[model samples]
Target: MTSQAITPSHGLYREALPKGCIVFSSSEGRAIFREALEAGHMRCYFKMAEQFSTQTELTFCGLTTLVMILNALKVDPGKTWKKPWRWYDDNMLYNCVSMPMIKEIGISFDQFVSLVMLNSLIIKSERVDELASIETFRDHVTRLSRQDDHFIALSYSRKSLGQTGDGHFSPVGGYHPDRDLVLVMDTARFKYPPHWVPLTAIWEAMKPVDETTGKSFQTEIRIKRTQYFK
Candidate 1:
């Protein structure tokens, strides 16, 4: 589910860390980060951390993740953000669709990939629904996280992760092979922190169907690079 921020005044929603997860800001999360770094599994985490940004809108999680990957890869936005600096902004992520539409409906996995590609980033995507086995999903996340030029990101159901929203997107910071957990740098910084999650649980999280597109939450392991396609 969503890490939907709860208001102390409303008392209608609350954020809870169910078993099988730990936020990065916590002591347990700190240990996981320390160990992952010592093991050389955090090659891309540093770069991604340089570009971390929170989602401006509740449904802007996909776009929020998109800009992080883009800037982390150092892709030129082809337009100036301030006066002379070229950059990627959440508002600048509407080449494939209108920002108003995306703001209203968010984006599907396919739409996310399309937006990434349209902005000149090259990504290698895997269809989670068509994945042959959970082991392969584990392998993809494991292998990608070790490389310095690649980072893993995916969209999965909140319910599967024992959260309360809908589908969400975030980058996988690192993996602890021994503990079999993956780091999820959540875009909803207000709701959740960068958290470590069991690998199998993350795979299961992506298996749920998205009713909007009538497809599974198709996830991807992407290469971070700026490409000028001919």
Candidate 2:
């Protein structure tokens, strides 16, 4: 999601009930709200905007920070805690995001994660060659293809996945059909962090046929985040 300018009507006042009453009515609350909003909790940003009722107070610096944070929240399945932390545990929402138009902001990771999370596909990059047994991972994707209904792979690095234990995980790009298990290895081990991650699903693309007209229209798929990962 991309970040966009938010008006008082759209930010705090947009809510049905009074917001930031506890956080912005007093001088101290206002200070806390300012800090929290800059900290980039999606809700806090909107609440601050709501409290001030003026978008002008939101400087470009604050807006940019919020945009990056919100954009990160939209993508990054691992950030959302969709990655398997263990065999038995269930998936959890990664971070909270409240900014409108936050999705429109261009984020490399968001773009990558969105395709995977929304498509029920796991993307692996060729740049993962730094890992000792990356071929095993590639083999895993290929094997998954046998069962996946739809999948995609790219040859270049749109972005790096950071470094892993062995070397930097260069982005190559590959996806699995209907699976959240991405097998690419990175030098950097991105673990579960405290935040919210939107649960995008591929089922949204499903459509049904119209019996009378003999035609079909796209159906909206709205599966809760926990359903697929759990």
Number of residue pairs clashing in candidate 2, backbone atoms closer than 3 angstroms, sequence gap of 3 or more or interchain? 26
Q: Tens digit of lDDT per residue, candidate 2, span 18-110? A: 221121235644444344334332232232122221112121112222222223223233333334531111112122223332232322333
Which has the greatest TM-score?
A: 1
* Global Cα RMSD, each model: 5.4, 21.3
User: lDDT tens string, model 1, 27-140?
Assistant: 888988899888878887888899999999988999999889888877888888998888988988887788889889998888888887787667877767553578877777
lDDT at residue 26 of model 2 (Cα atoms): 51
Worst 10 residues of 1 by lDDT: 221-230
lDDT values for all models: 0.82, 0.25
Cα error, residue 13 of model 1, in Å, equals: 8.8
Candidate 2 whole-model C-alpha lDDT, 0 to 1? 0.25
RMSD of 1: 5.4
